[model samples]
Target: MRRTGPTTVTPVKDTGPPGRGLLYGLGRACARHPWRVIGVWLLVLLAAVAADRAWGGSYADDFDLSGTPSRTGSDLLNAHGAAGSRGVAAQIVVRSDAGPLSAHRDTLTAAGQRLTALPDVISVAAPLDTAGAVTDDGRTGYYTVRFRENPAQFEKSYVGRVDAAVRALRADDVTVEYGGPLGQLARPAAADRASEAIGIGTAVLVLLLGFGSVAAAGFPLLTAVIGLLAGLSVLGLLASRYAFAAASPTLATMMGLGVGLDYSLFLVTRHRKLLHSAEGPVEATARTVATSGRAVLVAALTVTAALAGLFASGVDFIGMLGVAAGTTVLVGALAALTLTPALLGLAGRRIDRWHVRTPVDEPDDSGDIWHRWAATVRRRPWTFLLLGLLGLGVLGAPAAALRLGHVDAGASPVSYTERRAYDLVADGFGPGADGPLTVVVTLDKDHRTTGAQRDALARALRDALTATPGVAAATPPKATEDGALLVSTVTPDTGPQARATTALVHRLEDDVLPGVLSEEGATGYLTGTTAAQQDFRDILADRLPVVVGVVVAAAFVLLLAVFRSPLVALKAAVLNLLSITASFGVVVAVFQWGWGSRLFGIDETVPVESYVPMMMFAIVFGLSMDYEIFLLSRVRETWLETRDNHRSVAVGLAGTARVITCAALIMTSVFLAFLLSTSVVIKMLALGLGVSVVLDATVVRLLLVPAAMYLLDEANWWIPRWLDRLLPRLDPEGSRGRAESTGAAVPAGRVTR
Candidate 1:
């Protein structure tokens, strides 16, 4: 627990030049005082948890669309005291298997009365009180319950009381189910503990196979778990102060675990390699941090940068998701640099203890498959390049048909009460009744019209809306307390996310409302949960291109600066884009095209979740760069020494291939584990990310990169003098220390002919 800087560790024998001095210094400092480093991390985790308890934020589907029609209508309703800012509505669906619901009217009425009496319950309208509440068949009925605030903000006990009151009416012949936001509150928790267990278990198996020692294999998992806990704690604190989506924590955890393990794996692999040549534990740790630790830092920064690029999405909720994920990645990098080395120091030579088999030595190409593959790629680069492009093209084709929208309760599992209620209502009242839009009409304050004129205008507006092509029905207009506002409910003939329904909403706003309200000196706005979700979808679609452009531009600039080669940077950008597109195509095929929906527990095709594409693009783009940098850094190092593209490409591929493959497998396993989640969005993310990693590591990195580099030859290193001067030198491996530590010479015996 000393408070002194790391003293330089001189190798017993000079290898070449000193490498990665900053990272080595930091690692040496942590190694010298392992307990202090571990203790500080523990304190940070505890403090974050405490802060979260005192002032933690809650996750909600709250979206801010200031200029959209939904916002205007919402403002009008709240202005006239007709609706609370956080008002929520729930449906109580009742059906009788043996007889008509009318037979249980008295019981239903009593239950409605009970619901109305519950705390936070604004009112409850029984089936008998509203003409449309009863289905034409007479066996099914529903009641409407409005709440004063969003159910997410309500106390947990409140939902239990409401559940009790609603279930009280259930008889031998009657079935009662809840729907809407209340049903969401009542749904059982879907924990990812099982997913985490699976991911970690798989990682352990992979690590054991790769490292051949129990302690060495376990170290990565231990550091990753601790790092993930710290990241989630910090995310909780951020959520308390800001608006985050319900998916933020899950997404962040996925990223944290994947990167945490990968970063630690890289350093551990390097440490094990250096252990054979270095004089002692101190020098080996220092050299490992100096080289692989620096790569982890650069890779982590690239990921954070890509995530932060989500701000270009222009949606506050989506942007906050970026913040949540980016924060965790940053913490993961810090843990790799500090906590990982400390643990390694503590393990010392015993890291190879508790062996399952003999530990593998540093990667070399002596009769290795990777070396043979590299030689093949070099000999026929054109063939590999064409094959890789053709495969990516086929996989990416489905992306052209991608549709963006929200998934409704109908998509939930049959066991969920919400899904049951959704089915019941759809059978009785038509699919459109499950999602209805509200139209709010407000007269300008300076209007000269009299009260009678206002009434006439309201009637005309209602008739026009009902007559709209896609609108199934429009209720008669009702006036607010101040008489300045008129509200009517409109139901579409199609389901909420259907293209027909979206068309109906737009037509009502753009064609119907403007024409009808012009004569009355009033403006009409469409607002409701359905309307709001549609607006969110539209906004995501519009801003997606901008988000992609920003991310690509930033990553390209970063690569160009670091590699100092325009062709290399451009190749990285193109290959990453191909990987992302292919992954998107897979998502579209499975989720939207219903190709494998049943396998994933999806009942039917749902539009791609609106924010998913943007989220995936930023994440995949950044992550693809990780392997790009890791592999290319070694290539650049070799090319600088040999000045022979063929030799450098072969040597670099042989040295880094095993580590990259192992890292990719570890990440892919972590992402795939989340497929066990019941949440559809989580499933989509898990599949997309997992698939992207597989493609990037195998097809893009192994096949295409070598083929492309071999084809380009000296052109890959060509940089315009002016541009090279403008870009800052970004040697991921320290310039002065690299040669003295790891040395520039390739293993002479292992080099491919």
Candidate 2:
């Protein structure tokens, strides 16, 4: 049934084709050997649980300055020990309602003594020592506590003690408000726990809502949990070999659950649609496996490939993230292709038992919103195009002023011990006390410096550091050569003072040391958290273009080959850019600008992580494209048969909307689950990504895409008639046994007859 102009439309009914025999066979296998799939996955889950329990938490000093330059930069001060000059620096601001210092003297002394005796306590200085501890107002007092162990090396066990102490102090009517890296890190560990719980719960709720059947809703979540367990087990093994950071589990959980559930959603949605149309459940399940399964494999490969590019970053953490995320996605894909279909077969008709009330005489190709959208886009392509461009430009505006810096982990959400401890450090000790800078001076191999030369070099290094505007002071350089090497320490101003100090460190390295080294034929490597950040930014800027190009190129080829429509493929690529830009804009606003500073409990002054952009690009590109493929695949199926661009877009959108919405919801929930992790970077990444995916599926994919396509009309399908002739046909519409579809209408008795 087809109509030319807009008119009252009758809902089209689908009558699935006879080619469902393959699907039936898959269902039969699952029905006959349900345990086959269950047994294997169960074993995997069990093993993962076992391994996680056996292994401990992860904490690796990938950014330590004494190591290779990758982590040994100024930006990675705390990683190397800057809080102790560069380790975990905590300043506790203890206030009393008992009048003044004289009235609460005993309580303050007792609290101070208790803190000073804590393990790994370097030194605790209180107001009793001098006026340094008392605020200018004289009502508030600060206690400075430096850790003997590098904050990077602070043990979880030690953090627990500090947390207990903070709690116990409340009994004394003393409010313990603290700030620092130690407290920050501790805070998120707890939030991470809570966030994980919320994420898992959200996933379950969404799955049930979308699937509308208890069994169906629970199936994907079950699969995801299994995948998470297995992925974490593998993560544990990796932890054994590398200095994997604590944030890895959060990342693993997110990628595993989000991708795992989304893949299952796609497969199950197709399977159910087929069954509802009279294809035997078995047959429908098989077809879904073959078609959607193929799509899943391709999608997984694309994600893995994008993640793999992180290896080129030459940064260990980024490299580890690439490997870990890639592994989890692969594992999740495997589970989808194998375990999911097997589960469907086992469940048989029960899979579609959760059906919503279907409207009678639903248009086989009539009045679908997607169709209207396509018609509109085809008619007025330029308006939609311009509008899309403008939106992207607006979102990308904030990215221009993004400033990278080391954010205290406690600033994330103050529910963890680390954050409490960190706050204490900041309140008492000082800011910029958590991360420090290292200056490495290496002499020319030809120069064997005598004693006088060593003294001169030390003196020159100290004087140069002192003269630098930002540096608080420069300690004498320790000579270590056959006199070929020397190391010096420079302390920056406290807190805000540290900003100028960090700048001064850079000035010494960039403006001062280069000239000195060049003249002496020696090389100076200024390694600190600040320096490392600069390097990371440089590396990311250089490689981002390559990463974006590779992803776009790969996606274009895949879409082009699949749809046989260059216009369609190009549209997908452009839309992806829009999705990413909007998402990145949101990330920059929340994480970089600290706009909601008090809400997340992070300092507005905290710098954005240097690698956030690169990581976000790889992740957002892959995840966003997943939605792209899911939506476009249906549209392609419709367009191939009818060759009516508007009709095809409508039919495709109608068929896919429910499934895409469900999948997006699940994926967003899983990503937001990272908010449970104890790392600021992890939370920020998760929050940014989660918000973006939701927007992409709903706003970009659903509304704008269809509206624009609707306006385009026949032009949407236009290819240079000449180029169309040269390109080999990719769609299989002409082949027998395949369903015949018009761009607007799929005939009765197709897959979902």
Query: What lDDT does each candidate get?
Result: 0.83, 0.63
| lDDT for 321 (candidate 1) | 87
Report the lDDT tens digits of candidate 1 across residue range 593-701: 9998788888788889999999999999999999998889888777766666887788778878877888899899889999888888988999999999999999998
Expressed as tens digits, the lDDT of each residue in 203-247 for candidate 2 is 777766655666566677777667767877877777766766555
- All candidates: TM-score: 0.92, 0.76
Give the Å error, residue 574, model 2: 2.6
Span of 10 residues, lowest total lDDT, candidate 1: 744-753
RMSD of 1: 6.1
In candidate 1, residue 42 scores what lDDT? Answer: 84
| Candidate 1 accuracy as lDDT | 0.83
Please estimate how well model 2 matches the true structure, expressed as its whole-model Cα lDDT: 0.63
